[model samples]
Target: MLRAQRAARPTAVRIDGIVKSFGGACAADGISFEIERGTIHALLGGNGSGKSTTIKILAGVYQADAGAIEVAGVRHDARTFSPRQAWDAGLRFVHQQQTTFADLTIAENLAIGHRFETSAGGRVRWRAQHRRAQQVLDQFGIDADPRDELAHCGIATQTMVAIARALQGVEQGDERVLVLDEPTAPLPPGEVRLLLAALRRFSRDGQTILYVTHRLGEVVEIADQATVLRDGSVVGRLDEGEIDHDRLVELIMGKRVQAVLSQHTRARRGDVLLECDDVVGGPVRGASLSVSAGEVVAVAGLLGSGRSSLLRLVAGDLRREAGAIRLAGQPVDFSGPRHATDAGVAYSPEDRLASAAFLDLSVRDNIGIASVGDYFRRGILNHRAERRDARRLLSEFWVKAASTEVPLSTMSGGNQQKALLVRWLRLHPRLLLLDEPTQGVDVGARAEIWQLVRNAVDAGAAALVVLSDFEELVEVCDRVVVLSAGRTVAELDCDGLSDGVLEHAVLSAERAAA
Candidate 1:
């Protein structure tokens, strides 16, 4: 009977001629696609290429100007669809940002958005809720206790809990479809493997998934079919047999771009701009590194290797326990981030959404906020000068926005990152600290960011970057510093660095230390 029902309805989601326009920009222009039931379908696109807009339309967050959406054997006009309607049609979404409360228990977080089990008197049944949450967790193979605080679990476990929660009310025979947007963006490589394995399990159990991500390798590994969107239009589609890395890159980029890092040769290497002498703070233990003027140094390590800790210590986000840091040969201890910023230093954190960007503010304000002093007159802001500077920075960074007045939340992740970088780079600091600068950005924007970093170094500012992508380290860094177990293990020049070489070096150091 289940097989018969599956045979009768083949498509889980069918979107036709979806069109969405934001003022003068047509985000989704005549987009069309179909996801077969019980298969993993991938949506690929560059930043501001209408991928998010189309997904939002399907999620009923935005009313499309014109389109038809058929989900779970139910059809709804995109022009008048609502969130409740989408929910009733069995569509669930796990957005890029995590949607869980750290302070709450796993059971409580799972109960959110779904109808909680309650007593006849309308009081919540805590015991039954924990059992139900545990069942969902077990179903997804997530090793977490329902009664445990979500903050106690690792990031990977928290992510799986969020996914399991989304599938809580869904029954075995229900024609529900899950949409995951960049689910693995924040995870480490090992955690990503675990999450993909669980997703494959869901696909095997006759569940349909629409996975959106910038990681092409994961797409080839997990997706059965892929639809590529470029500039608000469908450019290519690939079946399981055709989903190779090179082919997908060509389709999404519209060019055969090599992933090789450019060999950067600085014309003049000057004195040390920033130096960490036996820095010991947070997870860092006796770590030491240096960056010279016109040089870009990258810290490379696996998860828990203290890469982020080193950066935070230098940026003054963490207090140094023991050791000293010198900037431009002057020994200085920063009391806080503001002190760091005041002393000719700039830091771009890894968590862009939480730390770097101001979502509620306009793009103009985000870009020009740090430089407000330059546009001040007798304690009054020079509005015209501020806007003019914002416009110039927007144009210079190639941010795709209709105008500066729009909220920063409206722009794509890549554009927001560019704006954030522009915000700090305008300071012309003596030292720059960047953590995962292009973690969620698409390929095209990545090149632009690399150029921006290079430009900064060329203008005599030194940079220290922490990245998980070894390929990016090979391309962007003049030297790579490997850290293991909170200690500096080895330092290698990037003159002939390859991904394999860097990985082998880090792993070899880990094995030695073990």
Candidate 2:
């Protein structure tokens, strides 16, 4: 039966012995894999493991040093392949970054590469273009007006528009491949489900998909096959029958990683470091929680369940509508993040690129930007002192970079996150607010991040984290405060918490309200 299925579907993408290098460093070292036609294949690996390099080779962003690529029975030399060649071969890509022009209307964005009807004198047929764009949007079940600006729509809608535009000219029976690189990275959990459902519908219609993500749960849910990459090599491949959470992690990490969070007993919980009394702001409604000094507390909930909102409220990133916050027995209302920071509070938001990291600046600049006053003397900027401080912080945080002066964009997501954390950790804030601290990070970096959080607590700093991964909550947190629909539901100690128990508590809360 398996042989029959293989023979029937044929191969959509075949990458043979692809080798790509940059300045004596091998990004993809003789890697190879085949994505079957009409199936969703997951590309899994850690940062610096060559997942992006291989995808770039496929999308024509990087020319392979040596290898051959075959798409839909048409072979192309890796050395000569370009992005245009890949596109002409029916390979489409929707990368993690937004590709649509935010200022342009949906119809105009769709008509980017291929414009609408034009008159002999060179006038664009606006009405016809809008109608055609609407037809495509309706076909994909995307609810948006073609005449509306793309910026007005949500990220999920913009993603669907990008995908629809990619598939505009291709026919149903054509052997087309769509590579979605972390498409759901910017979306909420509810939006993620919607995108996955759309991918399933596409697969049912015989469209091939290459799904790249750090979320293993998503892989198990949507992928028909998975190719695990480690150190620029194909470690293993699992068919639908072999894919599971533990097995996939083992393949990616090359070991049986303990599935649960680390079990460590701290000395003891200290005094109440931070407190929220009936806080209501953003999506949070009458929520209450507290973090004791030297303790790591996690806020647990589903998306839109007020987990992040609660953190933002405490961080002063969002304005509180009612209720009060107290720090060490003193009631306080912060005017903004700066006021909070001055009051011994630090926050790391989930969207690192947008909210946290300075992508255009150097690693040293990003690290030392927060504490520049420390190096200042007589109001004169001290470059030498700043560099010294940055070097020390980089070494302390174990941030992997070519040099401290290198652009923050040169580092991987994990290293960038470490830099951001180090920037705040250096402040020795009394309270730390981390929202999805390890959202897009890999396993190794995750261990390092947890260790850093624990180190902060050890130094008498309290931590209140918001994490979507329940296992992580079980591992690093001493206690978890469960929120349901913007209200604090239950507080469970992590000392004896199991994954099943934590999941049940959250789900039961969700269902109870439903």
Error of 2 at 323 (Å): 2.9
The superposed Cα distance between candidate 2 and the true structure at residue 248, in angstroms, equals 2.8
lDDT of 2 at 79: 85
TM-score of each candidate? 0.88, 0.82
Once model 2 is optimally superposed onto the true structure by TM-score, how far is the C-alpha of residue 107 displaced, in angstroms?
6.2
Instruction: Return the lDDT, model 1, position 491.
Output: 95
Give the distance in Å from residue 207's predicted Cα in candidate 1 to where it truly belongs: 1.4
lDDT for each residue of candidate 2 in 1-514, tens digit (9 for 90 to 100): 1211223367899999999988777889899999999999999998888899999999888999999999989999998899999989999999888788999999999999467777788899888988988888888889999999998887789999999988876676888899999898766555677898899888877889999998888898888889999989999999887889899888877888773347567438899988898999988998988889999999988777899888888878899999989999899888877888999999888887898788989998898887888887898999988888788888888888888898998777888889999989999999999998987788777878888888889889999999877766788999999999999999999987886799788889989978
Error of 2 at 176 (Å): 1.2
Candidates in order have lDDT scores of 0.86, 0.86
Off by over 4 Å in 1: 1-9, 113-131, 169-171, 258-269, 302-305, 359-362, 376-392, 404-406, 495-514
Q: What global local distance difference test value does model 2 have?
A: 0.86
